[model samples]
Target: MTTAPPVHRSHTAGNPDLLPLLGRTPLARIQADLPHPHPGFWAKLECLSAGGMKARAAMSMLSGARRRGELRPGAPVVESTSGTMGIGLAFAGQALGHPVILVGDCELEPSMRQLLRTYGARLELVDRPAPRGGWQAARIARLREVLARTDDAYWPDQYNNPDNPAGYLSLAAELIGRLDHLDVLVCSVGTGGHSAGLVGPLRRRWPRLKVIGVDSVGSAIFGQPARPRLMRGLGSSIHPRNVRHEAFDEVHWVGAAEAVDACRRLARSSFVSGGWSTGAVALVSAWAAGAAPGAVVATVFPDGPHRYLGTVYDDDFCRAHGLTATAPATRPLEIPHPRAAEASGWTRCRTVVDPLAAPRGEAPAPHIPAPGGAV
Candidate 1:
């Protein structure tokens, strides 16, 4: 054997750079006894990313903007987010030499607020929900006000920007590299970037792949009536244009209590769990795996548990919100169409339709700024 060269230690403890660690998150097999006993499904542990899965989108959006000259060097980047995307944009801003300004609503978790500030992003809070749209609308409205004052500010409107989904192509490549074959893909619907972005490329290889979408019970994305939603990271009051309604083969609406139950179960059994979106997707994924024995079902856990300690992981918070650890039904109640009736709990619909296509006012239109120019 040849002799090895001597190793040397650097003066610094380690590299402070976090940009290089953005993707290729670990995929864990989740086969919990509580939800469904099957041959276990795989979960893309996106929570292990530097700032959750949306970090991929954020970096792509900003980098694309710079290449197209839409974003000047060192200019401020502004957008509206609930929590996850804020963390993503904050991380991307630092990586690309841009200052991020995020508009969030009053109900944003304290942990998320502190984390965004710590990342050097300026946070603006909207006081109340809009009469027509909701917190999402209120946040976007406030975002416009901030954009109006800042010079050369670029708004990578995650709700409508094509670049948002385009960013996720790398994630699709990662999945293909790891798994030999995939049957079904389960994803939580929010701005609809990841699901819409991923399915097209994945389908190119697995042409018969089935895409299952998970949304909040009160979300209007799948044609349910809009109500005050407690869960974040999935579901939307405003119908985001980024959502490709035709992409989903089936849709499932998951409630707060059911999500909480799955989250706790996954944490206990598999030792890997996340927040609302993670639990919601996991519940549906288990059912999908059970429905077709041997089918390779995969889901994405968007965020980790640390940010949800005060809400999803806290006993007092669960009690206050009437959430319980009771396990969800083995199978979801089915509906023929999205608007057959308003879903209140764990429900599924096979015929998915674009809510905006029904009528002019069926779904609330997003109040996003037009692209191509600064405010």
Candidate 2:
């Protein structure tokens, strides 16, 4: 066992001193009374790390920046995040002797704001998202403004940076070491870091692996029009470039109520997975296990329940959001493309991207009738 470092230390992922705190989270097997037979579900308990999987990416990004001489000694680390990655960066900054600044919109939960501040990160809040870019864009513009003011600030743009996904190479290796063979890999897509990071290397090792992406109903990552994302860390109003669209075989969009049900049931039956993305991933993983006979579905549970006690676990809060449910509002809305014309459950698209929009826009693919023309 490695010695526990203090909250404040001087190290990054590249430093031999900090490697022990970042990756190699435990992989736990979970069984749900859904479907399928043996070779049950396995999930990497990412909360075991200091700040979960995001810390690993933060370490990797900062370390790379240090090596490239992008980060000055004792410079402030500034970036935009909803909560998860923001806390991760704050933890990283504390360890590496750098001040951290996290920029986000008001929707950032109070618990996260306090946690980041407790870790010694400066918090910057943007009033709203820009007309074109949305919340993420507003955060980015705020980051740029901060960067312009502080020349020493190092921004690890998680959305577009290659190093963000590169950080999870160790996580991928750890999963490979634990699992004998992985058939279905279910993961949530936000900045698309973990899914792209883990699936890329795993696919090379397990040639027949089916990568199933779990996204929020409103997220544009799968090419749907931007909508309000009730769930955090899983959905995106703007399609992130980090999402390797080619890496996925099929995608499932889960809603808030379905996620709440999944989280509560998993906590009681299998693992206490917190966070919106983990619930979505767990729901899809259970479905995948039932869909494929004798398949071992590996998923990533990125966090624990403490952060969600006031919301996902709070009955009153759930009632406010109309998330109180013993069953799912929608079972998995499988779509061929993110912007497909219609789908009740399963769908497939020949051309997933729009030629005019090219990247973000979704061209229509005929399937079911747009979920009663809702899409």
Candidate 3:
């Protein structure tokens, strides 16, 4: 009998391939059995990636590029990230035996810095962007200047790179397989990489799928005026070319307070530790799922809670930023006037108390500071 060919296992036993790493993230029915009157909403816990958030996909993209000769292996890899992406790149660079350098803004959290350092990446902090001209413009200029002075450095411009979107196609396929059908995909827009990347493939399969792009209230992305926002990793002060506007059926702008509350709720109820943007996206997902009956809402959780130790999770930082004090009997504050849409056709669910602009209504909910203030 023609016996089956002798099984020959690859050397990297128990090690997963790039495609597998890109998907099958823990899918939590965080909203199941809740009193919400919407279709089932699920969160693909990408924070469980080996590096966390977009890091796994980013690394896979870079590694694939190197294998295809798009990038030279062992070349010093340099890029700019607010946090999570840097850690991902650092992991990929180290694995591929490439030295990594990162350019970050001063606003980057200490925990993110520590993670990058642990991954052996050289960190360079640049000045915050110019207030009037746009922070991203200034930051990009700084990155270009750094690149000009550096030699043999590969710049993975996550903001404008096609690879940024290409890296997420596998995720789309995986989500499609897992959910069978997705009516809505909720994601927060930063560089627009994650949303843009997933939309293309998802649309090809589910042409009517609604892609809701969530931005922080102060983010200039989606053509809003630039303003300082307490929320990080979700909004941009400038429009990023990578954002696929056509792919989005609608957009929503979430504030920092609402996002923080959502984060706390997820932690308490589901034990899911999520970042600020992820919290904001979750809030939107919950809302959208409730708004549309029988809709399968899938949202992306970009990173874990470990990185926000100082700001979102810290008590002193919250008080300093006018956030609510954390109390033992604290409860999730309901969003007041949770139905204001901005001029850009995006809904603003919280009271608008813009210090730059006139206060529109009541103050935001009290922010409960985490005890011990350590991540």
Candidate 4:
């Protein structure tokens, strides 16, 4: 007997699925175990995206660019990322039948690397810079080199590109339609794209709304001296031009332990497994929800925790980093201390601090040598 002709999968199934395989993540009215005044606050579950948080917005931006003639058909796309954005670009490029080249620093997680390959992106690993110098300089240098040598390659420079923030603007618009009024929007800052992009549109619609920027303690973005940080996906050693400081009403500096604890709390209570940055945003949101009492707070859960299974979620790793227990719960409301004012560059609200809070001003000073030849 002749065997039936072999069945074939859809042509589209060869690549990592894009919009068709993705759906809008639910915006839940968090009530269980969360302290909030308006009965509940909305939590945008971004982890439900096909490639999680980054893929959802990245695909939208790339697709929009293609439709708007911003990108040539079949042009290869190149980007530098520590993780999430690269994964998103990989998936988006695959869906559009374009090749992707991802330049990543050595700090990239193994899972993220595997995901990029699975989505058919070529990964180029760059060496980590010297201690105290960090990877930003090295990563940018490598990206520039790759872009110069590659032909017909588009650099979706997420850090500086207007489209980066524009992508999040779409997300904010979707959120506004679901919630009647949002008192505050909390998000963790890396390139500051998400917060900067969302704040512009949301503020135009709701002038009274507050945008809170959460940053990891060692990140230079909020003005700390350049240093290694345990937290990933939030906080940067270099200033990203796209960060619109004026759009933020307040900023909070969180330590790694606090972020990890918050992540665990979210998992236990909401069944939401989130990355370190998401946990930091969630912690800030919970604090704001408690402090404001009658106000509605909304926050973005950037990505799922699976990519960080070897670090943030591992008890041994947490202990090794000296982040073994939960941090004390504190309200988000702030009464500025004199020391904080003296140390922080910009002073506005009691809770407001300069995004670049180190002795340096909001903008990064040119990498200059000090009198004694020190940085």
Candidate lDDT (C-alpha), each: 0.85, 0.74, 0.67, 0.69
Question: CA lDDT of 241 in candidate 4?
Answer: 79
Q: In model 2, which range of ten residues has the least summed lDDT?
A: 1-10
Model 3 spans with C-alpha error above 4 angstroms:
1-22, 32-40, 64-70, 132-135, 325-375
Instruction: Please identify which of the two predictions, 1 or 4, would achieve the higher TM-score against the true structure.
Output: 1
Error of 3 at 137 (Å): 3.3
- lDDT score for candidate 1 against the true structure: 0.85
- Candidate 4, residues 1-375, lDDT tens digits: the string is 222222222234225444665546778766534322324557788777766666655666677777777666777677878888887777677777677788787788888889888877888887667454478667778778777776666777787777777767657877888888889998888887778778878888889998888877666765555667767788888888778777777777666765676777667777875888877777677767776788989988878878878887899998887676433333332325312322121121334445444343344333321111010
Error of 4 at 337 (Å): 8.8
Query: How well does candidate 1 match the true structure in TM-score terms?
Result: 0.91
Candidate 1 segments exceeding 4 Å error: 1-17, 325-327, 359-375
Please, what are the lDDT tens digits per residue for candidate 3 over residues 1-375? 122222221222222353344445778886732223345588988887766667655765676677678666456666777787887786666556667777788888777788798877877776667766455566667667666665556777888777777777767777878888889898888887888778888888888988887887667665445667777778887656788776776666766655676777777777885778877788778877877878888998888887877777776887786555432112122234323223211244333232233344645433333222221
In terms of lDDT, the best-performing candidate is: 1
Best candidate according to TM-score: 1
Those runs of model 2 whose alpha carbons end farther than 4 Å from true positions after fitting are: 1-19, 34-39, 334-336, 342-375
Model 1 residue 266 CA deviation (Å) reads 0.6
lDDT of candidate 4 vs native?
0.69
